[model samples]
Target chain A: MKIFYELGRYWIFLAGMFTRPENFSIYRKQVMLEMDAIGINSVGIVSLVSIFMGAVITLQTAYNLINPLVPLWAVGLVVRDSIIIEFSPTIIMLVLAGKVGSSIASEIGTMRVTEQIDALEIMGINSTSYLVIPKMLAAIFITPFIVLISMFVGIAGGWVVGELTGVVPSLDYITGLQSEFLPFNVFFAMVKTVVFAFIITTVSSYHGYYTSGGALEVGKSSTRAVVFSSILILIFDYILTQLILI
Target chain B: MIQVQNISKGFYGKLVLKNVTNTFEEGKVNLIIGGSGSGKTVLMKCMVGLYEVDEGAIEYDGRDFSAMTKLERKSIRREIGMLFQGSALFDSMTVEENVMFPLTMLSKMDEEEKRDRANFCLQRVNLDNANNLFPAEISGGMKKRVAIARAIAMKPKYLFCDEPNSGLDPKTSIVIDELIKEITYEFQMTTVINTHDMNSVLMMGDNIIFIYKGEKFWSGSSKDILNSGNEQLENFVFASKVMQDLRRHLKN
Candidate 1:
C-alpha cells in the first residue's frame, strides 16, 4: 500500500512536468544548459568505461572459444553483439544512474530543503515544468547519442585489443563486426536509451522535489534516486528485450 | 488588501493551522509573529498558494485565490513576489540573472529592457557592482538584498516573506526589515511577513497577527502590543529576560 501510494505520487509528479512552459525561449536556453551538463560533461566517463568493457568482452570471448571449431572472427561478432545489445545501453545507463541521478536528486533536494522550490511555486512558475522538463528533454535528446558513442568506442576498443593481444587478427575482427550486423539492434538500443533517460531524470526528480528535512534527507534522496534508477533500468532492460527482441 | 478567512492546514492528520483569520493591509508591513512550529510559515505559504489550505478562503484584493483555476492564478501570481528565509536565490545564477529571472520568464521585454530593469532593482536594494557575481560568492546580507530585489522586480501588487531575518545578524536583519517595508509602501503591495523577530515587529510592523498553537492568538499594531494584556503574546514577545526588561523600560 505504501509503495502504491508513492508510485501514484510519482506519476502525479510526472504529469505536473508536462505543463506548458512559461517561455519557450527560456526553456530552450535551459535545455541547452542541461544538455551541456547531462550530455557533454558525461562524455569522458562514458567513453572511458565503454573502452574498458569492450576490451574485457573481447578477451573473455577469445578465452572461452578454445575449440578450433569456433572461428577467430566469431570473437568480434560476439563483442559487437554484446556491446551493442547490452553493455552500451544498459551498463552505460547504470553508470549514469549513479553519476547523473545522484547529482540531480541532491541538487533539487537541496533546493527544496532551502525553500528555493517554494519560491518558484510562490512566483507561480510551474516549478516542475521549469526545472524538470529541460532535464528530461536534454537527457532524451543526448543519452541516445552517448550510447552511440559508447558503442563506437567499445567496438574500437575491441579492434585495438584484437591487434595488440592477437586474440583475433584485426582484419578478421573488422570482418566479423560487419558480418550479420542487424540494424534493428541499434534501433532497439536507442529505444532502451530513451526509456532509461526518462527513468533516470524523472525518478531522480521525484525523489528530489518531494524531499523534506535538511541535508541528511537530501543525502537520503540522492541515494534513493541512484538506487531506484539503476533498479528500474535493469527491470526495463528485461521488459524491453522481451518485447522488442522476442 | 489580502484576506485569509478561516484558513486551516494539516499534514498527516496533524493540524498546523486552525481556523485562522486575518486581513493584511496594503502599502504597509503586516507581520505574523509566532514561536517555532506556531504555523506562521505554513499560514504564509498557504496565502502564497505554495500550500493549499485545508479549509477557507484566501483573497487578494477581491479575487478568491483558492477558488481560481491554475490558469487564472497565474495573473495573480505575476502580481505576487516572495522573499524566502534562506533568500532562495538561484545558486546557478548571478545576482542580475536572479533578479531578472521573473521578467525574463514572464515578460516579453527584450534583453536591454530586462537588463535595465534588473539593474534598477539591484540599485534600489543598494546592490551595485556585483551583478556578475554568483549567489555563492555573495555575503548573506547581499543575498537577502538580492532576494528583495528579485521579489520587487516584478513590481508585484502582493509580497510575501518567510522568516526573512532568520539567520542574519541584528544589523543586517534590521536592514532587511526596513528594505521590505520600504518596498511594500513604494509599490503599495499587500505585504505579509512571517517572522518571530521582535525587532522586526517593533521596527516596521504596521499590523501584527500573532499565531499561537495553530490558532490566531492576537492581532494588533506594534504600538498596541505592549498593552495588549495577552499573556501568551507577552511571553512570546519577551521570551528572554533582557527583552522583558527592555519592554518594561520602554513602558516606564
Candidate 2:
C-alpha cells in the first residue's frame, strides 16, 4: 500500500516538473551546468571502470576457452559483445546511479531542508521544473554520449590487454571483433542508456524534492535515491532486454 | 494589505492551523508571535501559498489567493518576497548572484540593470564588500542581511519573513529587527513576520497577532500587548524573569 502511494506521488512529481518554465534562458543555463556536473564530471570514473572491466573480461574469456577447436579470436568476440551489449550501458549506469544520483539527491534535499525550495515556490517559480527538469534533460542528453565513450574505451582496453599479455593474437582479436558485429546491438545499448538516465535523474530528484526534516533526512534521501535508482535500472534492464533484444 | 480569513490546515489529520483569521495592513510591520508548535509559521506559509489552507480564503488586497490556481497565483507570487528562518540563500550562488536571482528569473532587465539593482539592494542591507562571498563563508548575521537583500530585490509589495532573528545574537537580532522595520516603512509594503523573539515583538510589532496551539489567542499592537488582560497572552509575554520584572514595574 505504501509502495502504491509512493508510486502515485512519483508520477505527480514528474507531472509537476513538465510545466512551462518561468524563464527559458535561465533554464537553458542551468541545463548546461547540469550537463557539466552529471556528464563531464563522470567521464573519469566511467572510463577507469570500463577499461578494467573490459581487460578482465578478455583475459577470463581466453582462460575459459579450453576447447582447442574453438578459435582464440572468440575471446575478442565475447569481450566486444559483453562491453557493448551489457557492460557499458548497464554497469556504467549503475556506477552513475551511485555518483550522479546521490549528488542530485543530496543537493536538492539540502535545498528542500533549508527552505530554498520554499523560497522558489513563494516567488511563484515552478521549483520542480526549475530544479529537476534541467537535471533530467542534462542526464538524458549526455548519458548516451558517456556510454558511447565507454564502449570505445572498453573495446580499446580489450585490444591493449590482448596485445600486451599475448592472450590472443591482436590480428585474430580484431577479426573476432569484426565477425558477427550487429549495429542493432549498439542501438539497443543506447536505448537502455536513455532509459537508465531517465530513471536515475527522476528517481533521485523525487527523493530529494520530497525530503523532510533536516541533515539526517537529506542523507537518508540521498541513500534512497541511489538505492532505488540502481534497483530500477536493473529491473528496466531486464525489461528492455526482453522487449528489445529477445 | 493581506487578509487571512478563517484558514485551517492539518497534517496527517492533526490540525496545525485552526480557522485563524487576521488582517495584515499595508505599510506596517505585522508580527505573528507564538512559541514553537503554536502554528504561527504554518499560518505564514499558508498565506504565502506554500501550504494550501484546508478552509477559508487568503486575500491579497481583493484577490482571493486561496482560490487561484498555481498559474493564476504567479502574478501575486511575483509580488511576494520571503525571508526564511535559515536565510535559504542558494548555496551554489554568490551573495550578489543570490540577490539577482529573482530578477534574472522573473524580470526583463538586462545584465547591467540587474547588477546595479543587486548592488543597490546589497548596499541597502549594509552588506558591502561581500557580493562575491558564498553563503557558507558568511556569518549568520551577514547571511540574514543578504537574505533581506534577496527578498527585496524584486521590490515585492508583500514581504513574509519566517523567524528572521532565529539564530542571531540579541544585538544582531535587534539589528535585523531594525532593518525589517525600516524597510517596511520605507517600501510601504505589507510585511508579515513570524517570530517568537520577544524583543522583536515589543520593538516593531505595529500590528501583532498571537497564536496559541493552532488558534489565534490575541490581536493588538505592542502598546496594547502589555495590558491585554488575557492570561494566556500575559503568561506568554511575561514568560521570562526580566519581562516579569518589567511588567511588575509597569504595573506599579
Candidate 3:
C-alpha cells in the first residue's frame, strides 16, 4: 500500500517537474548522459545480444514455418511479427532493467543512505528534479535508439542463420523481410521502447528515492529495483500491446 | 526562528512524535536531547518538512510551512541548511564539488565564483587543501566538518542537525560541537540539534528541549538543567553511578 502511494506520488512529481523551464537544461544533460551510458556505452553488449537474438529468432521462425510444401517466404512474416510486437522492446527492457535499473537504484540508494537527498532538500534543490529527471529523460531519449539497434541486429542475426543453414535462399530471405516488414511496425517498436524506458527509469528511481537505513538497505533497494521494475515493465508491455498493436 | 507547534507523526499507526512544540531561536545552540528512539530525530524531521505532521504546523518566523505550495516550500528551503548524522556527502563528487553543490544547484554564481565560495567554506571548516579528496578518503571528523561546511555554504537562516555526534569519538564530538556552536554564533543561524551525548548537553546546549516518549517533557537552558527538579529529568541526569556521584558531590 505504501509502495503504491509512493508510485503515484513519484509519477505526479515527475509530471509536474517537466513544467519548469530549468528542468529543460536538466533534461538535455540527462539525455546526453543517457546516450552515453545507455546507448553508446551499452551498444556493444546490446548489439552482441541482438546479433545472437536475431539469428536465433530467425532460425526458430523458419523451423516453425517450414513445411516441405509451404513457401519459405512466410518465415519473414513470423520474424517480423515477433520483432515488432514482442521481442525488441520487451527483451531490450529486460536487459536494461538489469543494467540501468540497478544503476538507478544503487546510485540513488547510496544517495539516500548518505543523506545527500536531505542535503539537497536543505540546499533548496529539488532532489527529485535534480537527480531523477535527468535519468528519466535520458532513458526516455535513449531507449528507442537502443531498441532500434537491437531490432536491426536481431533481424540481422536471423538473416545470418537463414543464410548458413540453407533453409531459405538469401534473396528469398531478404525479399521476405522487405515485403513482410511494415513501417508502422518499426514505428510501433520505437514508441513501445519509449514507454519501456519511462517505466524502468521511473520505477528504479522510485525504489531508490525513499530508501532508508544504511549500506545494507541500499543493496536491497537496488536488487529490488531490478527485480520489480522488470516485472512491472512486462505487465505494462502487455497492456500497451493490447491497446496499441492489437 | 523556527517554530514547531503541536506536531504529531505516526508510522503504521504507531505514534512517534506527539504534540511536540518547540522553538529554535536565532544565534543559539538549541539542542533536543533524548534517549534512543525518543522521537528527537522525528521531531527534527517534522520541523524540516521531511516528515509530514499529522496534526499541526511548523512555522518559519510565523509563516505556516504546511500551508505553503510545493514551490513556495522549496523556495523557503533555500534559506535552510542541515548537517545529517551520517555526514551524507556525495561519494562521486570531490570535497570541492561537494561543497560547491549548494551553490551549483541554487546560486546564480558562475563556476569560477562558486569554486571560490566553496573553497572559502572549506577553509572556514579548516579543510583548505582537502578539496580534491573524496568522502571515502576523509576521516570521520573531517566528514562531519565537511558536512558542516556544506551546510553553512549557503548561509542558511535555519540549520537542523540530527545526531551530529553519533558516530564520532568523544574528542571529535567536542570539536564538531564547538564548530557548530561557532558557526551558529557567527552566522546567527537558528540552529536545532538532536543529540544524546551528555558532554554535548553540558558543553554547548545553550537551550535544551528534552523529549520523553514522543513528547516534549522539559524545556530549559543548560545553565538551569541541574536544578530542573523533574523526576524524569533527575533520573535521566543521574542514571549512571558516576553521574549520580557527581550530582551528589555537586549538590554538596
lDDT of all predictions: 0.92, 0.94, 0.83
Tens-place lDDT per residue, model 1, A113-137, is: 9889988877878899998999999
lDDT of 1 at B219: 96
Candidate 2 displacement at residue B177 in angstroms: 0.8
Candidate 3 per-residue lDDT over residues A28-111, each given as its tens digit: 765687668766777887888888877788787777875778678767667766776678889978899899898889899889
lDDT, model 3? 0.83
For lDDT, candidate 1 versus 3, the one ahead is 1
Residue-wise C-alpha lDDT for candidate 2, range B182-244, written one tens digit per residue: 999999999999998888988999999999999999999999998999888888989999999
Compose the digit string of candidate 3's lDDT tens values, residues B225-251: 888988887788678998888777877
Summing lDDT over every window of 10 consecutive residues in candidate 3 chain A, give the lowest-scoring window: A17-26
Model 1 ranges off by over 4 Å: none
For each candidate in turn, the TM-score is 0.98, 0.98, 0.91
TM-score, chain B only, every model? 0.98, 0.99, 0.97
RMSD of each predicted structure? 1.2, 1.1, 2.7
Best by lDDT: 2
Question: Which scores greater on TM-score, model 1 or model 3?
Answer: 1
Error of 3 at A49 (Å): 2.1
Task: List the DockQ of the predictions in order.
Answer: 0.84, 0.91, 0.56
- lDDT-wise, the better of 1 and 2 is 2
